[model samples]
Target: MVFESRGEKVFRFAILIVLGLLSVIALLPLLSVISVSFSSGWVVDLNQVTIWPKAFTFDSWQYMIDRPDLWRSFFLTLITTLIGTLLALLVTAMLAYPLAKKEFMIGGILMVGVVITMVFKAPIVPYFLTVRSIGLYDNPLVLIVPHILNPFNLIIMRTFFKQFPKELEEAAFMEGSGYFRLLFSFVLPLSKAVLATLALFYGVVLWNQFQHPLFFITDTDWYPLQIKIRQFITDPNEMPFLASRQEVNYNERTLRSATVVFAIIPVILVYPFLQKYFVKGAMIGSVKG
Candidate 1:
């Protein structure tokens, strides 16, 4: 390694200090939440719970574990995430592949339309009316179907697909291979990094689905995990999940923090596996030759 000058060393040390402070700042809230969740109701009420537990107890977690409704909502969110991600990958790939081809005459026009939608989102009233008209109102399918193809991810995938070797596709076509076979066998296998990245993107979005479910799903049973957490946050008494746990002495703060932690853990667990793919995919998808 090259020897650093005094000025360069000072600059590096300053940058390190700033980054370290920011990291601790970010972590403090998470640590506080964990601490509050484990603390007793009276301790939380006094606001004595900081980055360390004041009164160590598993009451909040025990309450969450015993709640069947919350578990059901968690399972629903998981299923929605898995199904939505798979469908998004399928739809995005199908749309992007044809748009990547220059020979497709309407590709540019369609792409223009997609980009325009990205620039100007549909107004809430019209969007809601459209969903209702499609008979998706008050349905769990509303969560999975309407938001399947994200325009930004579509563009990324299209750009990545455009970089594919045209010769390979031509050579496959010259042989007995059809479009579907060529796509599944060659294109998909080669585009694993981008696919994994997009899958993670879609999965995280679906797992954290709140606004759509809040707007469309009026029934408490159909609420996703985030919506349930929101309900607990806004009005703890109205949350049906805590109905059976009346004997538990958990406060709103502890319960809400625990619920938020539960909502976060699944996505955090998933990121490490796809992180290596994410950077490579993002670069490949964003950069066009």
Candidate 2:
């Protein structure tokens, strides 16, 4: 076993302390939201909540649970996350395969074109007009289509595919398998580490997407959870519980905290399942083979 010098041990201890503090700092907002969600509305209004509930209650959660709009928005966001992750993974993998191949002549040109998008983005107004002109203005495809492939993700996947084994692919071709067959049967199944990591990344981004929906979607029925959460923050009148303000102990702050808590819960729950693959995938994809 290797032994550490006294200085090295001290430095390691300092790094550990910093990381522990940073982890707590990262969780502070989430803990505050949970605390406020359970606190009495009056205590919340007074800004009395720190890390613990002043007067613990479940009124806000019950109110949010009973609202049909909340459930509708929640399911819409969930569906979008699932569909977006799968489509993005498929498109990214398919496009990366040929580009990873040294034999594909135009692959260099195409790779340059894709990299250019990473460096430059289209102007907002023109982009808006272009999307609208194509008939995606107010459609639900506004959510799914635009985010089908992220350029950075595409690049990472290309790098991963470049390091893939040629022997397996050659054997598959000898057995009469085509490009699509090799990709579906061999590449994808073996690339689960990277794919799972990217899936979690895409899923989180789609789930928390707020700005795009506001710009593209005006139809109330098509609104996702983020839009609904915005309403909770800006206009408390949109919350149904306020109609009976005199009867219930819960107020606007309590309900808003509850909504915020609900919005982030799904992502937190999903992280652990994919976490085992995250570090390995991330490090391997970041560097050349």
Candidate 3:
């Protein structure tokens, strides 16, 4: 093993201290919310709950879980996240394949347009008007359709595909494979790392989408969990759209913390499985070409 000099040791120790402090700073809020969610309402009110529970209880979680509105929003977000990520992956892959080929004539022009979107976004008024005209007003698909082909994801995929082996593609073609057949059977099977990374990207975007759902969906029935939680958090009294409204025994503080935790749960659980793929794909895939 190589021995570190005195200066090197000090520098390494400093980096470790900084990283450890940053980790605690990040974890404190999450720990606090969980503690508050489980702690008794009176303890929470008295500011006794911090990073750990003082009087542990499940009252807040039980109350929120019992509400149908919460589940409706939760399931709607879940379905949208799953479907949106898949659709995005399929469409982006199909587009990226053609663009990766140097001979695809209009590919350069299309890429310019894609890059332009990265620099500039559509003005909200015109964007809203256009979507409304397209008949997506209060439609659930409004979330999925607009996000189907993200520019950043497209660039990452296209750049990665540009480096794909041409000989394999030629061999497949010589063996009588069509484009879709080659893609599904050959190219894609070898693309799991980049694809998994993009899926994680798209999945997170669709899952955490708040602005679009809040603005597009006026019908409370179609609201996602983020918006529903926002309503309950802001409203001093019972939320207007909650069915069979009645006095909640749980403190609003505990309920709010629970809702926040609930929103965070899916991401926390899903990220670990994709972490290995994501690290490689995000780093190498984006900068490779």
lDDT (Cα, tens digit) per residue for candidate 3, span 108-145: 99999999999999999999899989999899998799
The numbered model that scores best in TM-score is 2
Candidate 2 lDDT, 1-289, residue by residue in tens: 9999999999999999999999999989888989999988888988999988899999989988998988999999999889988998999899988989999999999989998999899899999999999998778778888888888888888899999989999999999999999999999999988998889878888998887899999998888999989977898578665665676768888888999999999998999999999987877688983
Query: lDDT tens string, model 1, 99-216?
Result: 9988889999999899998999999999999999999999999989977999999999999999999999999999989878989899999999999999998998899888899889
Full ranking by lDDT: 1, 3, 2
lDDT of 2 at 270: 91
Candidate ranking (TM-score, best to worst)? 2, 3, 1
For model 3, the run of ten residues with the poorest summed lDDT: 239-248
Candidate 2 residue 139 Cα shift, in angstroms, is 1.0
Off by over 4 Å in 1: 1-17, 238-249
Collision pairs in model 3: none
